[model samples]
Target chain A: MYAFTYHRPDTVRQAAGLLARKDDAKIIAGGHTLLPTMKQRLASPGALVDLGGVPELKGIERKGRGLIIGAMMTHAEVAESAAVQEAIPGLAALAANIGDPHVRHRGTIGGSIANNDPAADYPAACIAMGAIIVTNKRKIPAEDFFQGMFGTALEEGEIVTKVAFGIPSRSAYAKFRNPASRYALVGVYVAKRGGEVRVAVTGAGASGVFRWTAAEEALKKRFAPKSLEGVKADPSGLNSDIHADAEYRAHLINVMARRAVEAALGK
Target chain B: MAAVSMTVNGKAVTADVEPRTLLVQFIRENLKLTGTHVGCDTSQCGACVVHVDGKAMKSCTLLAVQCNGASIVTIEGLAGADGTLHPMQAAFREHHGLQCGFCTPGMIMSAVDIVNRKGSDLDEHTIREELEGNICRCTGYHNIVRAVETGAKAMAGSAPVRQAAE
Candidate 1:
């Protein structure tokens, strides 16, 4: 890893100030992705603004009909949180399945969504549940927050503070993970709230995590796995790699989506 | 260079290190406690697992500077001061959990953490699932799973195990 200056800021204001002051300074929450990237020389920022010291960016609480999770809450914390378990059990299950125990202990929800990896689980959950990505400067809706793989609507010196997720009537996530890295080979998240239903797919999008509108439309008609029997995900823009070809990914998307719906229904 | 201060095992230690210096480097190089091995520095392999602030974390993935004011416990600190092995360590020896022993330290640390979080009565499936982060290429994980189950039971029978020095 390249040698760089590290600044540990105690507050969001101080963190933003440090980012503005330092050239090419990157925010380090859990440092799971950024640290590995730096170790491989894929990224070399001149300075790192460590957010681990900021107490403001931590905690998980239920507010009204939604859940407000602080950005710095670790994956382990989210998985073990009684609030998350009672409010949104599927979200807790997703958190529990990320990376592994050791990685979960250090990796945070804020870091995961901010990185916006194409294969990440949080993106699918956010988009499916219509979450709100709250940053120090503004609050961006989940649909507008993610741009593409490794991209977000975050501006320079912007730091994510928390994410607000509305508790859906029913929701669940299913993923076929790469055995080696445990990243999603093809993952689907299904959420249904009132008359609206959203189905989000991750790890198989050429562009990035995207909503499967056809499946969503079919499910809107009938919120059941059988409703998706004839629905198909077009293989055109899906990711193709050694792990799975575009056709296989498209096929798995249908299968995983059905599985997610089944899980949400406790079938 | 950055000056970092933290509690390792039972002692409070201070060191000057590069900003990029990993927590494993500090534990092994500066502190001269070499029990925590760095099998895969990229964080895929869990040979460098250690307890930081009462939780098992990948030391190699953490910058030493980030651990300032944190409490850390390596494999060397798991046993009693008089040299009695930790229940998990003893279980591993009895169950022959290691072949090359390269991944034993991390496996043991992770096992203790599992018991701490999930309780002592662990099933085989739960143990296998919880061992996801720590990879062992030897013993086919059969013996390791057995050791974890036995160790967890032993931990339940024993007094609340003291983690690191206060």
Candidate 2:
């Protein structure tokens, strides 16, 4: 790890201010991702503004028609939260399946969504559920928040405050994880809100996380595994890596989407 | 170097460390608590799993300075006060859960928190899924899972009765 100054501010405004003042400053949530990247010399920030101590960014609550998850809330918290489980069991189950117990305990949802790793599980849930990514400056729709691999629409000094997801009637996440890293090779989240169905795919895109529009259209009509049978997910822009090739990933997209629908339908 | 203080294994201690020093490094180098091992540079391996504020966490992913004033528990502190091994430690011994023991501490620590929080009614599938964070190159995870089930029963205070034989 490179030498850097560490600031532990108690409030979000103070932390954001510090981040704005320091050049090359990065916000540290659980440090599960950032620390490893720093250790590998992938990220060399001049300063680290620690958000672990920020009280404002750590909470989970049910508000109005949705659930509001604080940015600093760990995956374990989300997985174990009664509110999340009751409101959206699929989201809770998705959180429970991420990495492992230790990673779930320390890896924050904000960190996972912010990193926007194409293989991350949270982005798929966020996009499919149409959650709102609330930052210190504004609320970015999950669809617009994720730009590409390891990318997001977050601006400098803007910290993610919370994520809000409206309660869906039915939803589920299915992923074929890379056994080594437990990251999704092709993960899909299918959610049905009233008459409309939304499908989001992660880990299978060349440009990183993207929605499977064809599957979504079919699901919106039928919302069943058979509905996605003929829906051929275009592999034109899917990621091809050592773990899996583009063709295999496209196959996984179909399989995972179908399974997600099955899981959502309780089949 | 930065001045830091935290509660470790029920004792409050202070240390001066570099800003970039990882909690695992501080525990191993500064305090000489070498029970926590670093298996992988990335956070993928749970060999350095420890309990921070009563929850299992990968210490390699956290900064030493970040843990200042927080309560931390390591494998060294898991045993009973009279030097008796923890239930999980004893269960592992009985079940031969460890092959190399490199991953035992993290596996046990993570398992301890799992049963403590998730309760003893946990089935083998739940334990297996929860143990995904901790890796064991040897043993094929058969004994480790058995150890947790045995340990969970022991922790729940309703251990199976062993019948005396002639």
Candidate 3:
């Protein structure tokens, strides 16, 4: 990686101040993606404000009707938390399946959403479950938080503090992962809560994580996998890469959506 | 340059390193612990896996400066002062888990953590799933999985399980 100064701040204000004061500073949450990109010269910030030292961004607990997950909490913490498993087992299962054990140990929920990688699982779960992204500045709804591929509504020096996800009445996530990196080739998250049905598709979106309104509306009419049998998702805006073509990805989205609905109903 | 201090194994040490220096580089170059190998420059390989505050993490992916004041354990620290190997280490040898041995350190570190979390009740499928981070090209993971299973039981029988407090 290009040479850079590292600053470990104990609080969000300190971290934000470091970012504001530096010429070119980036927030280092897990460093799983940032460090590798820097090493390859794809990204080179003059300084890094490490969030690992901030204690405020590290935990998971039940608050009211949802689970309040500290932004810095690793995937392992979410997967293993009895509270998370009890309140939202589907979300916990998604966390457990991300990358491998080592990656999960280092990667954080806040970083995952903040980075907004096209194939990340958290965005799907966030959008499907109606999660709230609580940053140092303001709380943004999941739909408003994700703007596009590798993009979010976060501004410069804005730090995500935590994410609050309401416990869905029923939810399940199914992903066909690329075997090599274990990232979703095409993943679907199905959620049914309070007479509202929402389906979010990740990894296959050209515009990043998006809600499949057609399938969601269909499922809303009848909560069953067969409800989406006739609903063919358009392949127009799906991602096409070496792993899978746009047509195949669009086809898999339908299959995954059906399976997600089945899984959620079974739960 | 930055000054980082941490407990490695049972020893407290300090070093002045650039913020860009990786933890694997600090452990291998600064401390001369060569057991931790760097198979992939990227974080894809688990060869640089080490226990940071009792949790397995890719040392290659983390900057040395990020590990300040943390307790780290490398493959070299798995044995007793009397030269007795950790049960996981012992099981690897008995099960013939290594051939090239490039991935052994990471495999052993990840194996111990798996057992630490799952205990002796780990089944074949769970062992395979948990070992996903570690890649053993030589043995095709047949023996590595066996070693982890045998090691988990041996570790559970021998001492108080080290829970991952992190």
**Which candidate has the highest TM-score of all?**
1
As for candidate 2, its clashing pairs are A206-A239
Q: What share of the true interface contacts does candidate 2 keep?
A: 0.90
Question: Candidate 3 lDDT, tens digit per residue, A1-267?
Answer: 799988999999999999999989999999999999999999999999999999999989898888999999999999999999999888998999998898999999999999999999999999999999999999999999999999899999899999999889889999999988889999999999989999999999998999999999999999999999979889999988899999999899999999998888774
Which candidate has the top score in DockQ?
A: 1
Pairs that clash in candidate 3: none
What docking class should model 3 receive?
high
Query: Per-residue CA lDDT of candidate 1, range A1-267, in tens?
Result: 998999999999999999999999999999999999999999999999999999999999899999999999999999999999999988999999999999999999999999999999999999999999999999999999999989999999999999999999999999999978899999999999999999999999987899999999999999999999978899999988888999999999999999999999999
CAPRI-wise, candidate 2 is medium
User: Which whole-number lDDT from 0 to 100 does residue B41 have in model 2?
Assistant: 51
Worst 10 residues of 1 chain B by lDDT: B157-166
Q: Give candidate 2's error at residue A92 in angstroms.
A: 0.9
Location of the lowest summed lDDT over 10 successive residues in candidate 3 chain A = A258-267
Instruction: Report the error of model 2 at residue B19, Å.
Output: 1.4
- Tens digits of per-residue lDDT, candidate 1, B1-166, equal 9999999998999989999999999999989999999988888888999999999999999999999999999999989887879999999999999999999999999999999999999999999999988888774599999999999999996665545321
Best by lDDT: 1
Candidate 2 chain A: worst-modelled 10 consecutive residues by lDDT: A230-239
TM-score of each: 0.98, 0.95, 0.97
